[model samples]
Target chain A: MSAAETTPQRIAGRGAAPQRSLWHVILVRPETMTLVLLVLAVILASQLSPFFLDISYILRSFTLSAEFAIVALVLTMVIIAGEIDLSPAANMALSTCLFAWAQASGVPMPIAIAIGLVAGLAMGALNAFMVIGLQLPSIIVTIGTLTLYRGLAQIIAGDKSIRMPEWFIGIDKVLVFGVPATVAIFVVVSLVLGLILAGTIFGRQIYQIGTNEVAARYAGIRTRRIKLILFLLMGLAAAIAGMLTASRLGSVRYDLGLGGELQMVLMAMLGGTYIFGGRGTILGTFLAAWLLVVVSTGMTVANLLPAIQLTVLGVLLIVAIIATNLIYSRAQR
Target chain B: MNALGRILARRETGIAVMIVLFALAVSLYKPQFLTLNSLRVILLLTPLVMIAAMGQMLVLVARHVDLSIGSMLGLSAMLTGMMFRDLPEIPWGLGFAVSIGIGTLLGLVNGALVTFFRLPSIIVTLGTLNLYRGLTFIVSNARQVDRQFIPADLKGMSQTSPLLGIPWIIFMAFAVALLTYWFAMHTRVGRQIFALGSNPIAAPLRGVKVTQVTLLVFAISGALSGLAGIMYASRWGFVNPSNTGFGFEFQVIAAVVIGGVSINGGVGSVLGVMLGVLLMGCVAAALPLLGIPGTAQSAIYGAVILVALLIDRSVRRQGIARFKAARA
Candidate 1:
C-alpha cells in the first residue's frame, strides 16, 4: 500500500531517481548491511596493516568465521523454530575432547570420528527430549546443557590439552593449496544447509514451526517431529564445527569454547536472524559471518583491541536488531 | 477451605517444612551449625539476597526478566569502589545513597526498552548483558581497589552489629524485606502489578499504567542490587572483573523459580524468596561441611535447581488442575 502511495510522490518528483527499487530487501538485511560495512573495513584494514590481507592471516581468521558460519546456519534454523541450542559450542568442545582423548588412547581415527558424531546426536536428543517432552523453555534448557556439556569437557581433559598425533595433524592440514581443509568443509556444509533451509518442504515446515507452533500443529505439520529433526541437525552441525576447530588447532581444551555459544548467537543475530524467530535466511547468516571476520580484521588495522571490537559488536547488535525491525515494519507497509 | 487461605497455607507450610528439615539436617551434620554464630551467618546471608530477589520477583511476576542485574551489580560495585577511593571523606550514608541512584538509572533503561520496543526482554538483556558487562570491564580494566581505599568508617557500618547481636547489614536487609512485603501486599501499585501479571491486556484496559509500573519495578530492582553490591564489597574486601558477582544474576533467578515464582510472570512472594535464598545460602555453606569435594558448588546447585523445577512444574500443573476442577 505504501509502495502504491509512494509511486505518485515519486512521479511528482519528490525524491531523486526513479524510486523503483529493484534491490532485494533480503540483501539489505541488517546483517548484510553490516557485511557491506565489513567489506569497507577490510579495504581500510588492508591499507593500514599489510598483514591484514596476507593469505595466511586471512586463512587463519576466515576459517574460524567459516566454521562458526556453518553452525550458525543450523542454529539459525533452530532459533527460527522458536528454540535455540546453546549447547553446540559446549557440545563441540566436549566432542572434540572426546575424539582427541579416544585417539590418544589408541582408538582408530574413524571410530573416534564416529564417537564424536554419536556424542553430538545423543546430546541433541537430550535437548530435544526436554524441550518436547518435559515442555521446558528451550533457553533455560540450553543454558543447563551449556553448563553440563562444558563441565564434561573439563572432566574429560581436566585442564590439560590433548594434542593430535601425526595422523590427526595430517587431517588438520589444508587439502587444497594449503588453504586449510576445515575451511573447505565449512563452505560445503554452509552451502548444503543453506539449500535445505531455503528450498525444501521440510524447510518450509521449519518456518511454520517458528511462526506459530500451534497453528502448524493445527495444519497437521507434525511440529514435534520436525523440531526433533531440526535439533538433531543443529547437533550435527556443532559436531562438524567441533571437528573442524579441533582439527585446526591440533589440540583440545575444555575452555576452548568457553563463551563462544553466546558469541555465535550474537553473530547469527547480527547476521539478520530475527531474535523472536521465523524471519531470517541462512545466506544472510553466512554473509554476516564474513562480516564479523572482516570487522575483526578491520579493527586490527585501526589498532583497536578485541575489547573495543567486542563492545562495538555489542552496540552493533543492538542497533542492527532495532534497525532491522524498523526496516522490516516499514517494508511490510 | 477457601482459595486464598489454601495458597497462603501451602506457601507458609512449605517454608516451615523446609526450614525445619534444613535446620535438622545441618544440626545432624555439624552440630555447631545450630549455634547462634553459625546461625548468624545463615540469617545474614538470606535477607540481602531476599532484598535483591524481591524486585527480581516483581519484574518476573510481571513476565519480564533483567539479565542486566549482573551488569548493574558490576556497575554498582565499580561506582561504589570509585566513590570510596575518590571521596574518602564523604559520609557513609550519602555514598551509599549515590550508589543506589546510579543503579536506578541503569535499570530504568532496561525497563524502558523492554516495555516500549515491544522487544522480547530476553534478547534485550542478552545484548545489554554484554553491553553492561563490557562497560564495567572498560571502566575498571585491570584495576583493583583494596580495603584500604575505602573509608574505614564507612566500611565499619557494613560490619557493625546492632540488632540484638545481628549485623546491621542483616537488620537492614530484613527491614528492606519487610518494606517490600508490605509494599507488595498492601499497596495499590502492588495490586496493579498483580493485575498486569495475571493478564497484561486486561490490566491496561482496566486503567493500570503499565509503563509506569514497569519502570518503578525496574528502579526498585536496581536499587536493591546496588545495596547488595556494597554489601558484597565489604564481605569480599576486593573486586575484579573476572569473578565479581558473576553468577549472581542466574542464581537469583534460579532461586526465585525454585521458590515457586512462576517464570511466566506473576505469583510469588518476598517471604518465599527469603526462604529460597536461605535454601541457596545453606547449600553453599553446607556443602563444605558435608565434605563435598572441590569448590564447584555450581554442580550441586544445578542439580538442586533441576529437581526443584521438576517438582515445581508438577505442583503448578496440579494447582491449575485443581483450579479448573473447582471452577467446574
Candidate 2:
C-alpha cells in the first residue's frame, strides 16, 4: 500500500477536466463541511438562547471540555498513525487518582504531580508494549487497559472524592489574557500540535505508517519506535488533561471523566478523521470541540435532559462517521 | 513445534486446570471453600453470563463484536419489567418472548447498520450502546421496576430447581450453549461465518452471503442478550433503568476471550466458553472466602482480561513461528 491508496482522491469527470475553481475545492473537502456545520451549530445555538452568542460565555463553557479537546489533538495524530488509545479517559482517572492519592498521603504537590505523569507514562508504555511489542490489536488491548485503569482508580479512591487544596483548585478561574487558563492551554496545544502534524517530516511519517505499516517498515520508517513514542505522548497528554480536569473540578474521584472516551472519539470522528486511519487535521478537531461544546450547552440551556443529550451524542457519532466515510470513498472514486 | 502443539492441546485443559488449582488454593485457605453449597453459588452466579457468552462467541467468531449487548439487555429487561408492572393479569411466561423479541429487533438494527451502511461494528455498537441505554431510560421514565412489581413466578425461577439443586434457569443457559455448539459445528452457514472471518475477501468469492451471515450472528447475539435480560429480572426480582445489564458486555467478552475464543475471530468452541464462564464463576465465589474486598473484584476481572490477552498473543506467536518453520 502507498500514500495514494489511503489519501482521498476526487472523482473528476471522465472527459477533459473543467476549469479549476476555488469553490469546487472548498465544497468537496470534509474540513469545509465541518466548518459549515460548526457555523450552523453556532447559529442554531444562538437562536436557541440569546445568551449563547456571548463570546465570554462560550469560552467559559469551553473550559468544561477543554481538557478533552486538548487531548483530542494528540489523539488526531495517533489516529492518523493507524492506532487508537481508548484507555486515555481511564488513564486520566487513574493518573488523577494517583496524583490526588499521593497528595493526600503527604507527598509534596510537585512530587505528586510527577508521580502522576510517570504513572501515566508507564501506562502508555504498557499499552505500547502489548500493541507494538507483542503485536496485539489496539482495540481489545485498550479496552482491557481501560478496565484495568478505571478499576485501579476505584481501588485507590474507594468511592471518595479527594478535594484539592484551595490554591490548586480552579485552573479555569485562572484566566490568561482574559481567556480561561484551560481554554488558553487548549488553543496553545492545538496550534503547536497542528503545526507539527501539518509541517513536519515526522508527521508525514505518521501518515505513511498508517497508510501501510508493513510498507512503511520496509521503507525503513522505524514504525514500532514511532508508534511507541506516539503512545507515550498519548499518556503524557492524558496526564496533563487529568490534572487540568482535577484543577477545574477542584476534586478528583474514581469516576472522574467516566464515559469521556465517547466524547473524545466523537470529536475526532466529527472532525473528519478517517476511522481506518491515515487522514485528519487538528484544525478540524479544534473546530469540532467548540461545535460540540456549543451544541451541548445549547441543549443544556434549553433544558434537555442529560439522557436525551446522550442520545444526541450517540446519533451524532454514527452520522458523523457515516458522512466522513462517504466523503472519503467518493473522493477516492 | 512441540511447545506450540502443547499450548494448542492445553487450551481447554489449561482452563480446567486453572479452575481446579484456583479452587484448591481457595479451599486450602478456608477449609469450607470447597463444598456443595459453594458449587451451587458458582452455578447460580454463572448462568446469565454463560448464556450471553454463547451469543458473544458467535459474534467474535465472525470477526465483529457487539458492545451494545449490555444496553440491549437493559432495554429488553426494562421493557419486560414494564409489562409485568402494568399487566399483572397476563401470564409471566410471555415475558421471554417479549424480551427476546425486543432484543432481536435491536440486534437487527445493529446488523443493518454494519451490513448495509458498512460501518465498523465496534463504533456502531458503541454508539448503539449509549443510544439503547438512553432509550431504556426514556421508556422507563428513569424509574426502576420495583421488587413487588416483578411477577412471583419470575423470581421463583431462581429458587425452584427442576432436578436436584439445579434451577431451570441453569438448564436454560446450558441448553443455549448446546444449541450454539450444534449450530456452529454442524451447520454450513455457521461454518461460513468462520470462513468469512478467516479470509473475508475469499469468502465472497467462495459463495458466502456475507451480509446475511453477519446479520444472523448479530441477531443471535441480541436475542441471547435479551434472554439474559429477562433472566436478570428473574434472578434479581427488579430492573433499574441505569443499573440493569450495566457493564454486562465486559463480563461476557472476558469469559469468551478466556475460553480461547480468539479475538481475531474464525476460531472458538462451546466447551471453551463454558469452562471460561466456570473459571470466572469460581473466582467470584472464592473472593469472599479469601477475604478480598469486593472492590478488588472489578480490578481482578480487568487484570484477568489483560493476562489472558498476553497468554493468547504468546501462543499465537509460537503457532506462527511453527508455521513459518514448516514452510521453510
Candidate 3:
C-alpha cells in the first residue's frame, strides 16, 4: 500500500508514463484562465481603439471602477464570512444625499463626511441586529432593507439634487503618479486586502466561519463578531465610494450609486466567488473590476453603442457565473 | 399536507371575511362602489393580475423569486405592440399565443439559472430584471403605439359585460385562479414544490425532480406576466416605455408575499396571492379616485406591503409557538 501510494497512479494508456505531481493536476485555476482572457480582451480592446491607450482615458476609467472595486473588496469579506448587504448601494445613495444636505445646511465638510459614514455604520449595525436577532436569512433581510433605505433616500432627496462643494468633488481627481486618487485608492486597498486575506488569522477565521458556521463555532471562533465586523467593513467601503462619487460629480444626487448593487454583484460573481459563501479574494474581484472598466472604456473609446457594451457585460456575467459553478463542482469531486 | 390544508383553510376563511368587510366598508363610503359599473371595472382588472399572481405565487412557493416579471411583461407587450400596430389584421387569439410563447421563453431563462446554475434565484432574476428592462429600452427607444392602430376586438373585452354585468376579465381571472389552486393541490409536482420549499435537500433525496419543477414554475410565471402585459397594453391602448409597467413588478411581488406567502419560500397559496393583489389594486384605484396625493399614493403602496408582511409574520409566529407547544 505504501509503495502504491508513493508511486504515482498511472493511467492504463499505452504511452510513456506521464510525469506528474498533485501540483500539476491542480495547475489549472479559473482565476488564471480569466487572467488570460482578460489579457486577450485588453489586447483586442486596444486594437479596436487607439484612444483606449491614452493614459488620461485609462486613468479616468479606473477611477470610475475604483468605487465598485473597493466595495467589492469589502463585500468579499462579507460573503466569505457568510452574509450580504444588498442595501449598500441604497445606503451609499442615502448617505451621500444626507452628507450633501447637511453640508448645504452649513455643516463642515469633515463633520458631513463623519456623519455620512456613521449612517452606513448604523445601517450595518441595524442589519446585523435584524439578521442575528430575528434569525432571518440575510438575502431576504437585506432585500427588505434595500427597499427601505432607497425609500428613505428618496424622501431625503425629495426629487431634488443635493449639491456638494467643489472641494469634495475634486478629492478623488487629484493625481498621484499621474493617475487619479480614486484609482490609487482601489489598487492600494486591494493589495492590502490580499495580504490580509492570505496572511492573517482573522482572515482564516473568516474563511472558517464561512465554510461551516457550526464547525467554526466548535473550533472556538466568534462567528457572529466576525460577521458584524464584515458588515461594518462593507458599510465603510460603501461610504468611502459614495464620498468619492459625490466628490467626483461635485454634487450628490438621489441616485448617487443607483443600480450599483447590480454592478457589484456581477463583478464579485465574475471574480469566481461562491454565492453561498466561504470562497473569494480581493485580487480576483480587482481583476474583475479591471476587466469590466476596460471593456466599458474600450467600447466607448471605440464609439460602440453603449447598449452592446451592457449586453456584453450581461453575457459575461452569466458565462462567468455558470462556468464558476461548473468548475467549483468539478473541483469538489 | 395537513399543515398546508390548515393554512389554506385558515387563509381562505380569513380572506373571505375580510373581503366582505372591505366591500361593506367601501359601499358605506360610496354607494356607487357597490354598483354594477364599479364592480364590472374591478372584474375587468382582476383576470390579468390573477393569472400573474398565480404564476408569481408558484415561484415564491418553490423558494425562488423572479424580479424580472415587469421585463417579462414588457417583452411580451412589445412583441404584441408591434403586432397590434403593424399586424392589426392578425387574430387576437394569435396575440395570446405569441405572448405565451414569449413569456415561456423568458421564464425558461430564469428557470435554467435557478436550477442549473445553482445560483440564488433572486440574483439571477435581479440580473435578468435589468437585462430585460435594458432590452426593452433598446427595443422601445421612445417608441409609442398609436391608439388608432389598436385592435378594437381586444379592447372590447376590457369594457364588455358578459354575465351579470360582469366583465369577461374577472371570470377569466377567477378561472385562472381556480385552475392554479386545483393544480397546486392535486398535481404530483405541486406537492413536490411544497416538499422542496420546506426542505429542498430532503425532497430531492426523496425523488422529487426539483429542478424541473422549479424551472416550470418560473416559466409559468413568465407566461403569466406576459399575459398581464398584453392585457395592460390592450386596455390602455398604448405602451409608454418610461411609465408603463416600470414599477409594477415590485407591486406584484409585494402583494404575493404580504398575502401570506412566506418570504422564505414554500408556504404561499394562490388564494392568498389573489386576495393580496385585489386588496392592493383596490387600494391603488380607490385611494386615487378618492383624491389622494400622488406621492402619498406611492408611499401608501410600500406601507401597505410592509403592514401586510408584518401581519403575516405575526400570525406565523403565533402559529409556530402554538405548534411547538403542541409538540411539547
DockQ winner: 2
Candidate DockQ values, in order, are 0.33, 0.55, 0.27
Candidate 1 Cα lDDT to native? 0.74
lDDT of 1 at B30: 88
For each candidate, C-alpha RMSD in Å? 4.8, 3.2, 5.4
Q: Per-residue lDDT for A240-289 in model 1, tens only?
A: 78877777677889777665765688667776777777777777677777
TM-score of chain B taken alone, candidate 1: 0.92
Candidate 2 recovers what fraction of true contacts? 0.51
Query: What's model 3's TM-score?
Result: 0.87
Q: Evaluate residue A117 in candidate 1 and report its C-alpha lDDT on the 0 to 100 scale.
A: 89
- Give the Cα error of residue B264 in candidate 2, in Å: 1.1
Mind giving the per-residue lDDT tens digits that candidate 3 earns over A1-333?
Answer: 333463454423324545566874455455655677678878888898775667687778788767877898888778777787677887788777777888899988889889989988887886787666556667766766666666677777777787777556686669989878989888899889888887899988988888999999999998888888888777778877888888887877776787788788877877777777888777778788887888888878777655555556666767777777787765543
Candidate 1, superposed: residue stretches over 4 Å from native: A1-28, A50-56, A65-67, A93-116, A151-178, A247-253, B2-9, B15-37, B44-48
CA lDDT scores, all candidates in order? 0.74, 0.90, 0.76
Select the stronger candidate by lDDT from 1 and 3: 3
What's the i-RMS for candidate 3 in angstroms?
A: 4.8
Top model number, TM-score: 2
Residue-by-residue lDDT tens digits, candidate 3, B1-328: 5977787658655765666687778778766776766655555655666778788888888888887888788778877777877877788768878888898999999999888878788778777876776676677665766677667777776767677766566667788888888888899988888888888767877888887998889999998888888877767877665555666666776677767788667898877778877776666556545665444443454455555555666777898999999999
